[model samples]
Each structure stands twice: as C-alpha cells, then as structure tokens.
Target: MTTGDAVRNRLGLGRLLPLGVATDGAWLTEEAAVLVLRTAVQRLPAVTLGRVRVSLADPAEAAAPTVPPPPSALPPGALRIEADFTAPADRPLPTVASELRELLWSTATHGLDLVIEETDLGVSGLSDAPAGPAGHPREKDMTAARPPGGRPAQPQGPAALAASAAPGVAHLASTLGDPVHLASDHIRVEVATAAGHRPLAVVGAVRESVRGALGNDGRPVVVLVTAVGTAEQPAEG
Candidate 1:
C-alpha cells in the first residue's frame, strides 16, 4: 500500500475541484459515514443491514451566488442516506424502520455533523417466525404532484410501502442473514445460509417479502446467496 492508498482508505473523501482549482484538506468520506451507519443499524433489534448508500449534494449547487448569499460559501455536508435491511416479521416493520431512521438521522446530524436531507429505508426481507398479532395494518397516505399529463405521480422511496408487508409474512428465515442493497426501484439482496437450511427456499421467501413491500411494479429485485456456514458457525450479515 502507498501513501495515497492509506489516505484514501482513512478519509475516502474524493478530489475537490472548484472551477478547475483543486482544494486541499480532507472531508468526510462515504465509507466513513457508512461505517457509522452500519454499526448504528446493527444495534437495532431485528434490523440487519444489507447495504448502505450515501449521496452528498453537489458542492457546485451551493457555490452559486444568490441575493444575500447562502449560508457560508463553505460546502454544506448535506447527505441522503439509503439502506436495505431485514427485520423479524413479528416486529412492526414501520416501527423498526422509523427507529432505524431516527437512529441514522441522529447519527448523521449529531454524531457526524452532517445534514440529513433524506434517509430512505428499504426492507429487503423478513425472518421467518410465527404469526404476528391479528390486526389490520395502518394505511400510509402518500400525496404527489400531478404532472401536465394528468396522471398522479407515483410515490417513490423505499419507506413508501413497508407497512403493507409487515403482517403478511411471518418472521423471515434466519438463513438470509446477509445485507441488502437498494436504490431507486432496484433491490439486491445478499443471503447467507447454514448447511441445514435450503438456500433457494430462503431466497424465495425473501423475494416474496420484497415483492409484498414493493408491489408488482415490475422493478428488478436480485437476491444472491453469498455464504454458507456450518451449523456451529453462522454467516454474518
């Protein structure tokens, strides 16, 4: 490893070029933020992280001059954090998602000192378990601006459909222990298994849950079984 590699590993902040002038000094890297986010999500119950993606607003967007000027020409650390996770079916999905969102939002805002523009939670699967308490799940209301075409714009974001899928499936099978990756309308799930568990069965279950949460919108959902461990030693998410 060279000096550049070491610096890049420690502070994954990318090159800063403003009007062809390169700026010096290290900023927070996406990897650093992801580490913080993953650790935080792991601490939550039934919330296993599959994947984490972070997007920072363009610095040029803030550089534009306006009346009275924006809040300091210094680039603001605006962040949009998205994650794919699996939770036990027994636990309320909305509640789990809400807690995770608050946890990440606080971690980004207070711990990392970054501005959280949006934190989208994508539930990739549920661990298999017994039936949950009987009750109709609360409906989520999403309003969108209608375009000139007159068709109401559809709701976007992973959190939009979590509630509907919570009660349908029992807890997800534990074998699908790996993390998930989701962005826009795409979902990629990584499943881990043991010698006794059937990988295909687990993947099918996860796919069903994903379909339930996302609906049959024709979006692509990819599930990959990445690891198989012995019964004594299980794979990690």
Candidate 2:
C-alpha cells in the first residue's frame, strides 16, 4: 500500500469510548472525539498540543455500556484522555498545566459528553511566545463511517428509513455489509452523526426512532455511532 494509505489506515478509529452509563450509552470514535478535543485545546493561550489519545482508565473495572459496543468499539467504561503539550516558559508552569488539564477535562466531559475519568498531562515542549492559530482539527474522512463489520448502507426497508430520519443522525452505515442488521433477539444499526450535535445524543435519538418504527418485538434496538460530522464536513443525506 502507499504511504498515505498506510498513514490513513492508522488514523482509522482505535477504541470506541462509551458516551453514557452502562444502561444507555453510545460509542464514539477516537478520531471524531479528537477532532472536537483538538479544536477546544487550540483555543487555549500559550499552549501547543502534541500527541493526544483517549482510552479506558481502568478496563478491569469498566462496565460495558447498556448497549454493548460492536466489534469495532472498545468494551464500555470510564475513559481517560492523555496528551503531550508545550507550555510557555515565561508563565507559571503549574498554572499552564492546570489550565490545559481543565480544558481537557471540561471538553471531554461537558462538551463531548464522554464519561471521562482522568486527564493525564505531560510536558513535551516549552515556548516563550504565545500559541498561534496553526491548530487545525484532525482531517478525519468520515464520509464512509459505519459499523466495523458493516460495509456501505443498503436499503433495509422501513427500519433504515426510520434510522436516517432521526434527529442528529447523518445517515446509516456499515463497513462491510448492509447498514441494518436483523437478528432473532435484537436489531443493530451503525450511523454517522450530524454536525452541531453531540454524538451520544444522536445515538439516543436514533435508538428511540428505530425502536418506535419497529415496535415492541422483544428484540432490543442497538445503535452505534461510527462517525461524527464536523462543521466543515456537514452530514450527507
């Protein structure tokens, strides 16, 4: 494969963190979450971010979300955000680090609606000058976002229609096969979220919409958020 292809491959999502509690929650892609996080961090003064990653703080004690993550997502639980940053040498280092830590914590919890447990910080570089506007959100190509095993979205009758029509949902997806999967005990759908909405909120709306459309069949409705659209990348029809 080409070098760009290889790099892009690595950019594909790592672990899908749970958005809510074990009873009712949604899975969010690391890349999608990072896009929101990076944007928020860039607003900080005298700080330039380095590598950033999010994962379960303690997988051993993590509880799986109400809806188990698909094969593409990580096991559910409280997660953490760890990153390397450059602080201004002129300012008090502790203060700068504290600001960075608060920003990470607030963005992950309040902004992204993630169930984050920790925010680990490390010093990577020091700068005397103020931070510049070189910060750009991750260029994640989420046009093809879908459930891990799902391919492109396919016509799944009324069920697919209901899922797409839900608020905050961009569209239905599957990395490999049809977007909607039907089983004896449950129904699963992977979706890309619409811009300007929380991924977890979108997931909840979708679950409700699909559930209503399908009626009470004793088969639970499952929704997975595979991709989230940014302001620059508005969701498609």
Any idea how many clashes model 1 has? 9
lDDT of each: 0.44, 0.69
Candidate 2: regions farther than 4 A off: 1-11, 132-156, 229-237
Lowest-scoring 10 consecutive residues by lDDT in candidate 2? 141-150
Residue-by-residue lDDT tens digits, candidate 2, 82-135? 999988787788998998898788777765678888999999989977544434
**Backbone clashes in each candidate structure, one number apiece?**
9, 8
Per-residue lDDT, model 2, residue 80, is 86
CA RMSD per model (angstroms): 20.7, 6.3
TM-score for predicted model 2 compared with the true structure: 0.77
Tens digits of per-residue lDDT for model 1 on 1-237?
655445434433222111101121112334434654555454565456777776655555443321111111224345567889887788788887888889888766654445677888898999764433332221220111111111122223442233113222212111112234454655544333333333334445556666677666654554433232222211222
